[model samples]
Target: MALPTHFDSLYIGGSWVKPIGGETSAVINPATEEVIGKAPVGTGADADAAIAAARDAFDHGPWPKMAWRERAGVLQQLHDALMTRKEEIVQLCVAEAGSIVPVASIMQFDMAMDGLQYYIHQIERREFVTPSSVSAHTNWATGGETLGSTVKVYEPLGVSVGITAYNYPFFLNLAKLGPALASGCTFILKPAPQTPLEALILGDIASEVGLPPGVFSIVTGGADVGEKLTTDPRVDQISFTGSDKIGAMIQAQAAPTLKRVTLELGGKSAMIVCEDADLEQAAFAGLINLTNQCGQGCVLQTRQLVHNAIKGQYIEMLKAMASQVKLGNPADPDTGMGPLISAAQRERVLAFIEQGKADGNTLVCGGTIPPGMDSGFFIEPTIFDCPNNSTAIAQEEIFGPVVCVIGFDTEEEAIAIANDSQYGLSGGVFSQDPGKAYRIGMKMRTGGVLINGGGGRLNPSVPFGGYKRSGIGREYGEEGLNEYLEIKVIDFRAA
Candidate 1:
């Protein structure tokens, strides 16, 4: 299962084509700091070509006109094709996205496949057409009588462009791709420049699965390429997963065309440890932000709101668990954590560590590069005991293996602290009483909440997104499928 050394072409119009500018960028292995490959760097011309192809496909393509079952058959073929190459895909993710084996295998690969399957299942059950009750009204003044029946039709929104983040390339791509394709929208993907290899491979998969021309395309490049796609009038919708700043920019860029936008932005989510919670389980679950994808996940609970009753014991357990996490090469099967996406990302996390120090937060452990790990963008799992939830470390998304432990005096205080941030993406509440946990979870101003780790599983059937500034629109489940669809009402009159 050797990975491809180079991705030298963009996949557009269901064919492998060279970039219009003929420029390429080196793909670096974040864990090793070595050039793993060179991916084609697309430009505005490339984006225009992709968007045009997608527009043409949506305008006059068999895919959108095909029966839902027929489309499901094609998606089923894609899922099987991806499954056959799962191992190779995981390895490529490790090389390209700095994802450790478990994270790459489970979070990046398996979860994506599951999401695609969920969409396929939904396609079978979803009814795109709904009939309304027929009514009759008479105007006495004109002596006019009318009887009519109306039907609401959900149709594809035409061409959709998905701009994904670097942390979970494959997962995020499918998070957007599954819904767009399931709802019969032609898709164009612009992956993060740092991790385009896996996405290029996805293009290969889509081509091999016999996806119709213009139904799918992948154009890889920097922000300029994204701007081209967002500003273009032909693209009917934009699904972007990245920082809030960039999400705002994309929203603004798409305003003139009035294209629909679904933004899955950043999060500074919290984990509340209730006074009656299981301290051991709570501590282990709290380490998820530090271990999984090295805390690069937007929804990872980076803010820990522990009750003052068990704060000391919980902090000690967290320290012990954090220390045991093995950080090194992502390819290692036993490694619990890996490096940040790049040196720049490592520097950013380090700067936040310094800021935490300046803000007078207690540095519990790990604030520097790990010993004997100098060749890669590796940082030790850093933890802070903050006085309040107002510190920079507690509020902003660090996107690295950093956690802030904030003490709360009561349950009400915990809920207030968790909802006190600008972000409301995901959070968790741990308690011995299920009713208590549910009560607190419902009060939190976030989109998703986990009780007792929700058995440490992610259900694709559940809608995943954010509230407030965290994001707009949702992904996964029926809500995700609706994002790519537009409604049309038809009225029929009988004489």
Candidate 2:
């Protein structure tokens, strides 16, 4: 398929319209750091228009009044349309964001489709505008005679702003938007500049699937645009996924206006490899999970807390497995990994590695850019033997393919090291002892924990969010849908 080089304007109110003052950003293909395409650069005014449109739809337009069956039908149609264009979506993601083709095709696309389908499946289970349950018909009081009343209500939270990170654009969007849509809220989606094409394509597909005017919109730009979207009071809620630093800024700015905010922020997750674990299998799986998506994923387990007795063996196996990560063009079907999002990102990762060295960590495997792929924003699948939980490499979210190995003496110490972080999102434990693994997973204080190979189902039927600054609200479940709803108790006198 021949890729288009540019999109003229933001998609809004069911139409591609010109912004009052729109700019443009050249979307770079990280694999080559080459400007492959351009996305519309939206300003505050653009955000204003999109937000207003969304607000109108969510509050007073057809979307708010649309029956649940209609919304479900549209959602299913969108799902089918997206399914038909799965290959194209993968291609665009690979080109726009340096996403690995195999992973994008296998995990990202299919899972997004699954989430959409799940949302469709939910329409049957939902009862719009439910009333409070009542058993006794007569008025009753404890000691004194009193009148009984009933309550019933539910409605949309007006417009919502959705901001996605560089990794898993489709997956995250569905997780955020699906529930909002189910609640009858309209959306203004801002895909990461690194991967806006897929989102733009998502909006287009949604439109084709007969999503109503002003029901869904997309404005693509960089930080400035994101700030405008988050700051606008017309936006009922801001759902963001990215760094902690940025999430803080959003929270601070949003506080004055008291915007409803949900931030899925940064993490330096720990992968605990216990004594009785399959060292080789664990090591290889760990390497893949850490380095996948070029380590752009915020939940990527960048820290490995290994047992002292088997630390050396785990390190050796991890080194060999890290060597197997082949980074190249995203178009290559066999490529397991790709490049970072930009030259600046690659430099940042390198600086972190240097800081690790200064902090007295040993470079076990890849420390430099891979031998031959020097032109692109490429960093090796690097690992450092820091062994100290507080080391710079061990604690910081490198946001690159860099893993730090730390040795723990006992089970208590391993759990201690795992919990010693400001952010807790996702974690994994590898132990032959299922009981121990389960116990550790429970005690580890994260949104999700895996006994062995931790995986994110993100089923639309299941809730997903993090704790302690990882995020404010859950997504992809019944609870997620409620975030977009306002509960009202209609007092009905029961005589």
Candidate 3:
């Protein structure tokens, strides 16, 4: 596939625009360490323009005033447009982000389409206003009885900024954009510098779809652009997906304006393998997902908690599976994993591996760069036997293809270890006894739990968020839409 070397302009206020800044950022291909594309670096002026445009749209444009069905129709058109470009988008994602073909096609491409379509479906059947039951209340001013009725209405929260991660750029953008736009909120999208090309394509599609000017915008830059969007009072809300470190910064920046923020941050999720569990299935599932997106995902189960009795057997199964995984070119159908977003990210993961080794944790198979494939920012699928749960490698969120197997004596210990971390995004349990697994899952402190290998996969119809530092608000489904809406209550009394 031929990649565009230069996107000469950024998309703002529904138009192809020249960025205020002359500097540009190169979008490097992690697989080959080549500059696949370059996006015009956005400046504070660019962010101001985008935010002002969104604010204008929300305050006075036709988008917020349009009926629910009218907005739903536009969402349907956007969904159709995305469906038509499925192949091109998938190929672009693979080229720019080093997403292995199989995973990219489903996650970065197909699921994004599904998410937009899900929002469209939601609004098509949605009720914008609901009537509350009538009740009688004392009229204090008149000193008389009054019969009253109330109606509740949902309204958009004005301008929203979506700061997405590099791992799943397109999906995260759509995850926030689709619902926010569908809910009548004007939006400014800021894609991560590591993978910004595909998101730039989204701006093209939005324009081609004839979305109202100033209703949607995409700004491409580093932390400064994001900071400008977060601190500016014009931006009414922020939906961010990335590390906890940045999420905290966003929360702090939005504090002065009290902007509503929905954050999907990092996770050190656990996959508990019980004594009676299908050892091979549970272990393999955990390992495969651990390397999914080269372990860039926030929701993957990185902490494998196996009962002490079956730890050896489970570790062996993971090793066997890890050996068979092909880790070369992402375009190859047989390749199971790909490089991290950049050399910097690969080094970060490698540093964590070195730390694990220094801590005397058992290195179970990977943990080094694969032989002969030295050009790409690649790290082997690494695992460690971390006996102490308090160890840095065991406790921290190493956003890479690394897993730690912590042995637990009982279900209580397994739950305790899983919930011990500050993160509470998603978790899973494996056991032959469904009831036992269910009981354990219920006790977990995480926001979402899987019983018998049932979670981790995205279900657009349900809510997805975290507890503790994992995140503040939910994304996907009705919960996601609600994040962009505000409630208003109106009372009617007999006159």
Candidate 4:
């Protein structure tokens, strides 16, 4: 991979400048294992500068006072600039995020464009908001006094810290950024250490659109920078998409400050396949969700709840499809699966594979590395049929291309086993019987459910989030924007 020296240096208060320390972090092409570019190696002081910039933008700048129509125009401009660089963004994201080249490119660019359009349409459709509650008194209408509380105004909250994970860096950035920015709140995004280039590109687009300085900033760094951003007093909200352990820690740290927090944490989502389901369709959906994206997605159907009547047949179908998943180089367009994020993650996946074997699960497909692919962080798409739900593989989030298949006797049993995990993110149920699908979907308690054939890819209009341990708050819709806003009621005194 060729390294690009001319990259987004750092977008600070209305200006792009070099890092204060003059240090940089190398971005890698996860697929080809080469240095691609460098993002600023931000420090605690840099975080302070970003926060101060956001605070000034919020408290004393025109961005906060700008009319809604003007603000909407700014967002539209940002969308247009991003769309123009759609292909470039795809290439950058694929190189940085290891998403199998063009597929990753499509997701980073085309999908984000769709989300931006969603925001534009959604904001345009809303009428002026009226207050839900009002107080009126007979004596209220004194000399030159107003009679009734006319409206409830929504105010943008202060600055927000948006920390994205590596697996879906570009998508995650837009998922949080769209709602936060559309709500009129300023934001500073901290991309994951593994993939910061996508966020950098997004920051560059913001600059290109003349997004007011202090309104949006991108400071790329590791755990230290993330900690500084989360703990800082200037930031009013913290929205993070990552592991549950880190989510808990941030929650604890942010409690003393009383900062508003939104977390889209980890999940062990399940896909239940009932006996009444069309075997072919259910199996296909199951494998696609799990194996595609190399099984790094959080809402993927990692647990396959198969009815005992069709367990054998379903396993056979799953095996055939799994074998067809071509794995070698992500740069190859035909490659079905890509490598995990890093060598440590690859080793982690390997340990879980060993654990599954020790727990007496039946290993069906892909337990070792792909042929001619031992250099990069690659793992085989693994499937395990554990007779009991108590197995380690069923209990843990492997965060790799490994899935667990558990047999169930009844609908109730399937739901029970599926809901047994700590995660309630995204899930699905496949059944030709509409009643059964609806019934099971209603009972699953996940954030999103695909009855029969719905996929994880969502439109910008749809609200996406998780429940229970899976996540907090929503992303991508009207309600999502509201999450970043503070409701304020202004009582009129003059007639």
Clashes found in each candidate (C-alpha, N, C closer than 3 A): 0, 0, 0, 1
Q: Candidate 3 on 1-495: residue-level lDDT in tens?
A: 333447979889999789987778777889998887788899989999999889998899999999888899988888898888788788878878889997789988888888888898888898879998888878989988899998999998899999999998888889999989999999999998888887888877787678999999999888889999999988889999999999999999999999999999999899899999998789878777668999999888999999999999999889889888889779888889998888888888999999999998999989999999978888899989888688788888888999999999988889899999989998999999999999999999898988876854578999899999999989887998999999999989854
Model 1 per-residue lDDT tens digits across residues 1-495: 465759779999899999989999999998899999999999999999999999999899899998998999999999999999999999889988989888888989999999999999999788889999988878466679887788999998899999999999999999999999999999999999889887888887898788999999999988889999999999899999999999999999999999999999999999999999999999999988667888899999999999988998998999999999888898988888988899999999999999999999999999999988979899999889999999899999999989999999988999999999999999999999999999999999999999988756668998899998899999987888889999999988754
Cα error, residue 84 of model 1, in Å, equals 0.7
Candidate number with greatest lDDT: 1
Candidates ranked, most accurate by TM-score first: 3, 1, 2, 4
Q: lDDT of each model, Cα atoms only?
A: 0.91, 0.80, 0.88, 0.80
Residue pairs with colliding backbones in model 3 are: none
| Model with the higher TM-score, candidate 1 or 4 | 1
How much lDDT does candidate 2 score? Answer: 0.80
Candidate 2 per-residue lDDT, tens place, 329-443, comes to 8888878788888888889999999999999999887778887886778888888888588877887888999898899988889899999988788888999999999998988
Better of 1 and 4 by lDDT: 1
List candidate 1 stretches off by more than 4 Å.
Answer: 1-3, 139-145
